[model samples]
Target chain A: MKGLSKDRLWAIIVLLPSIILLGIFVYGFIGRTVYVSLTDWGNDPAQAMALHPVIKFVGLDNYKELFSGFLQSRFRQELVSTIFFTVFFILGCLGAGLGLALILDRNPKGEGLWRTIFLFPMSLSFIVTGTIWRWMLQPQGGLNMAPTVLGGQPATFGWMSSTDAIWKFDWNKLPLLTASVVGLVLAWVAFGAFRRAERTRAVVAAICAALLLGWALFVGPNLHLLAAPELHGFNLALIGIIIAAVWQMSGYTMALYLAGLRGIPEELREAAQVDGATQTQMYRSVIFPLLAPISLSAMIILGHISLKIFDLVYAMSGPDNTFTSVPALNMYLTSFRQNQFAMGAAIGTILLILVAFVIVPYLSSQFRTQEGHA
Target chain B: MTARAERLTPGRIGMYLILLLAALFFLVPVYLLFATALKSPDAINLATSWHWPAQLNWGSFRDAWDKIGGNLGNSLFLAVVSTLFAAVLGSLNGYALSKWKFRGANTLFALMLFGMFIPYQAVLIPLFQFIKSLGLYGSIWGLILAHMVYGLPITTLIFRNFYADVPDALVEAATIDGAGFWQIYQQVIFPISIPGFVVVIIWEFTQVWNEFLFAATLTNTNSQPVTYALSQLAGGQAVSWNLPMAGAILAALPTLLVYILLGRYFVRGLLAGSVKG
Candidate 1:
């Protein structure tokens, strides 16, 4: 018979505020969101009720409209873009991050300098990241100046302009040199070169920061003037968002991989080397197998973040920027921007359903492993 | 690991090579910020092969400070309050879920786990509606509420794993002595859990301080957090790049200082017993 002491009650009382807030603001809203998604509220509160909104007993109709591309008309397209963004984003961030991790793990001479350089971009908000990247992608800004300097004509084409020319090009065979390709290809090509080139490394390294600043300057208003091409008229804005996100988040991935790399058993590597396993084999078979768990974890986290990415896209494209849409952004526009609260809530619930599908199984597996030990 | 000791093998060189290349990929953007911040605006605008800033413009810091509302007061306030709230409540929630075997405890814990999965953007609309409904919209407190909701799940998860490592014998002893929950928690439990507490505090503080989405969407004024304020500096007007750079540096300084000064704690706190898996 443990008695509830006065302080115990007080402690519980003190936690009441937080608990109440979480229960209502978090769990409650989620429930409401699910409920609202079932209704056909449309854009007007009047149609909410007049359009059969008795809490609208339409079971799965909203979900149908969402998938069928009927209700919002833009839902299906947005979903496709969201999925693409997620795939590219996850891979890009992980690749870049791992590459960064490998580089920084060498215990470089100026370790702090490199660490600070990698992490500083993370300090800026998504808005800033979006703004900076927008500037760097501009035809007249720092980004194009390189081409102009290299005896090439200055780029007047706005990569983010419209999607018109895209559909005409073979989607599968489209040149990797697309505007969205800027961050990924450039990071891989230019940055990759500087990474491996030793003596010139120091020289290029000295100039690397200037290049980043050049990109940052173009991230904001410069992005707004981007229009559509006459053909596909697809917004390349999504590409910029993905690029910026990968650039910013790769550092995080690198840090995680670095930690994982450090945890590898040295004795195994030594044994492999003594047996004459080549560097490629050691990495491919041994090191890679060992890094799997960390890699998987990184992938999971990166995938989840990519799926839910909004800040970079929203800030760069804005509410009306309309280059592309992720699930979160779609949800935001439906609710706040378009006044279709019910539809937005529905989209949110769908996102939650997707998130739950991934998270619940992973969590349960983890819990089971823990319980096995217990 | 002993392979490196055996000889300066080609493999080791390759490893170093890989490490160097990876480092460059990660470090460029950060380096650029410093280079640009130090450069005069005129030089920055000039496309002359992107060299180091001709002369250091330390005044960019001053410009950033003024443009970003003259100080980082709003950011500091939101971060401090959110961090403290998350730490205290998270620890308490962890304690309740871990130690107090009340009815629905497991269910409540599982329910709270959803906080991590629901991205800030997903809840932005409903949350905004909810906050506006509560009449707390546009206030720092509103942003605090939003951050706290997400902060709890992670913080509690960390503390729960940590508290699970605490043997039940001490708690049982205190209970047998009629010392009740609070007494055992304060006298017997907390003092020994300093390491876990530090980890929770550090993680929560960084999460709150570095947070952007809620801070930006929930509040619209300079009275918002530094992340949002710094963001607005760039988005608001066609001001000098130096101004936003100042705000960027100022916004970044607090976490950077903590990382530098309390680095050991930051590092240890990061990888300690607070388990996510």
Candidate 2:
């Protein structure tokens, strides 16, 4: 009994420092950031940088301004850019990664060598990738001149500095669009649940879907996120950034999919083969279905990455380039460079909330699985 | 090999072609980095940017070295020291969590895991304040401290998961021999933890070395890591592209070398740290 108590004591002693450090650095600091975000510490330029700045509570104004203030359209546009970037980044990575993994699953020659070639980019910092890609994407020089080698005229596409945008939408319609998207997703989930005969899940999802769609179709059109029709779209400049990001991250998804592919039993493939299933049918029906979980996980991870992206954009187009800016970059420039501490904290808190939405459920599910195994 | 040989058809040809094209797509920027770095400032031009250098100019590397060599040293110091500290702390935490298994340990670990997924911007403001209060701001030590604290989650999670596989029977046997927690860890767990240490060390080293946000925000010019210096070099206006290319290579060399040499463990660490377990 004494020995057990002693060992337990030692265990607690050993864990004490890490527990304290994480408490202060992670949880405590997060609370402090949240509190800071609720205060007006930066509206006064003179007091913003003071050692002991006088501050007052200003609840939700910073967030309200970010979403709706006339002078803060840049923040609104950045939010739009982040959404488009996340969608496209996840899609590009998933598509490229699945293709590579599928090809490699054929037991290609020098498979390890090919994997190394593909994944080597994963090891380099985003800064290095950004620096190199910035040069390769130079409008006059690198890729634009590649066609010249093929005896074609030099192409004139501006890679990173383009000001053009496409698929423009009114900011006033954001609430409606968001509700519709959620409604559609829930409806799809409910349909899948109903098909699987999961009655409770189907009913719950159906009810939620119905409620959301009803609200969206009936009440959402009356709501507006902005006073006027402020336009936002998928900026053409993000295509280059997206390509560079996909290049750097697609290997990660490829690795994940390759692992998932390898985990499936060979007997399953042989069974399908003995049943005289063609290659395409076997893959479509068998392999891709098995890889769905991996694709979902990859999307979550890649989505969060694109959501909080800073360094790559900073290194490529720089902090001042409003076209390529993300909330993270804006937070840095706002808080550190401009000394707007409260505003910066607000942006950071918003980013944290966005990440938590994706991460919390994922982590809880992971923990549930861990508990099941234990 | 025989089965693969028998399957050589038009589809195989197309697959190989696709793989080759993908490989080229990935390799083009690397080739550009090297090609641009080898060219003289005067020789770099839009028309001939894709062409190989007429004469190799190693001076660009030399110039880049002169500009960013100190930052490289700082990065080396930061990565090595912080990696060592985080690895040791992670091992201890993993030991306690895995074998100790106290009340609420799993819940505590779950909370810690949440720290790893945060965007870092969320904690930047208060972390900056804390570091400044400690008077460690704008120094390499501040960056090291930050890395150590923030690095604990992934490192601890990896080691805990690794140690979970260490077989309770082994620890139990040691305990039966009258070994306490520390003694059992030292005699049994620690010796077998070499592989775990390798994975954690490599992961943390590569992360600390290649990391930019903390290095960029926390460190002064003299204490900046190679990534920040490379960013400055590249982000500058109207400079010859050769310098930035060379700087990029210099900044990337350590992690790339680690990837080349210890790639198996590197991938293991990557998969382990992704929180799927």
Candidate 3:
């Protein structure tokens, strides 16, 4: 270290500020936040008490309260909503984005104009998009009234206010439901692995499925509900917010897919065409499979956005609407508005874990793949 | 396949129609934003909610401006200052990491990249307390600092990748010319980084301009950015569709203009940002 050149020494000096700034402001703050989250900083420190609030190390009590406490059911509900929202949002963006990208890949006239128009919404702030969609999705008017102008009855659906959730059931049944779902996906994965003759991977997936199904059948815990049958399901109210998010993000997906589609060598498609494959068949058999990497990356990108969704939901549904409450929004209100810093941080930590669940794997795999290619 | 000719068959027409419909779907919200923003309060009545105003009303924009003008100024001030700071710092860091590679530079850059994915929510609690301790609790400068901290990751990544493309011989030549690290940056490195700077500026400015969580939490009414202000317009008890719509457009103007004028760069920035980031 002492033998380093003058320029190298100067480089170290020049880089010190960012190193210090990001280390403190970014990494240090995260560490500090996680530490604070473990403490009893402001369990009920509403208003004046927040300034000199009680701060104590309560360990993971906040987490326990959120996941198992009776009154903190909202957190669990929000967790479920986030999962559903992420799925729907990713699907919406991918489907619409792929469709748009496929169209643009044909190199039609006005391609530049259409591409720009398609991707422009990705530029606007979420608050603005949310505002526009709020007006568009109002219960009494907006999209509903378009029918009445044509001498038809206006739709009575409460786009963002509907409290009814689909597939709702007792909270006690949740473990069973989740285990079944996990079991099914594992079974599918196992079957694929078996067909491909990947013995170890197939056995691993089969074991996972067996464990999940065993839990569903015997070991799953029954959560005591605040209500006799606490139902958690797809909240119809979030549909509007989901639509707004998809609208804002689909263009981003479109650009990715369009680039990917263009990158596919024309010879591949030409060969398929020469083999007498129909256009749809060509896309289905050849093109779409080639776009798998694009889809994976898109899913990861959209998954994170959907998980940390705050502004869009806040702007569209406002603070008062709990039915459409996402984890980020709930975290905001919990920490800032309600003075439950510990609880809010717990929620934030959970969200971080959920996102990390997706992102950490994706990023590491991507890096590995890049390294392999190199 | 067949020859280069693409005959205008019914299928071609159908594709065009589908694209047109997608275009319409995308345009509806932007159209509604302008239409509602320009409509008078009376013209925003139920039956005419989707109608073009009987008369073009610029008054609503004025009204919205009067309410949020200060916040808009704060947003501009913070975004510009923060963006400038982030870009410069990012340029310096990027230059050092990509070119003057020392031991652990790649590791440090990887560590920094982790910051990009940290959910702001995870740090909001401590960041607020930290801001308070630093006496920046309710100030726009606080927001600037916060944005810089958050903006560093991507900005650094962008410039790092950009600078990586700079041939090492250029830097080596500058070294032979008796240039110091900063001197080499000024002459050899900075000139080629204009495009990188553009991408970072547009990316950070748009992000910080449109950011809501930090602004809402960190600032008071007097110092809040327009994102917070626009959100307040909607979240306020009285949902005045017209004025809020106007405020939304006003708040969105800078980013929207960036998109409209330099959209190609914006898209390019976004693409590069994600792939590399």
Say which candidate scores most in DockQ.
Answer: 2
Worst 10 residues of 3 chain A by lDDT: A365-374
Q: Rank the candidates by lDDT, best first.
A: 2, 3, 1
Candidates ranked by DockQ, best first? 2, 3, 1
Scored against the true structure, residue A153 in model 1 reaches a CA lDDT of 65
| TM-score of the A-chain for all models | 0.72, 0.95, 0.90
Candidate 1 matches the true fold with a TM-score of 0.76
Between candidates 2 and 3, which one is better according to lDDT? Answer: 2
Error of 2 at B82 (Å): 0.9
**Tens digit per residue, CA lDDT, model 3, B1-277:** 3346778989899999999899888987877788888888777876677777779999998999999999999999999999999999999988988888787776677678767787889889888988888999998888888999888888888898888788888888887889988899888899888999998999889989988899889999989999889988877757568899999989888898999898877887787656453
Error of 2 at B199 (Å): 1.3
lDDT of 3 by residue, A1-374 (tens): 33578888887897898888889876787787778779877775552155566578989888878766788778778888998999999999999999999888887887889988988888888988888898889888787787876789888889998999997767767767889999999999999999999999999999999999888877775544244566688899989888889889999999989888878998998899999999889989999999998899889888988899899988898886889998899999988888787778888888888888877787667555644422
TM-scores of the candidates in the order shown: 0.76, 0.97, 0.93
Q: List where candidate 1 sits over 4 angstroms from the true fold.
A: A1-20, A40-42, A45-65, A68-73, A100-124, A146-236, A270-279, B1-20, B35-60, B99-107, B167-180, B220-222, B262-277
TM-score on B-chain, cand. 3: 0.94
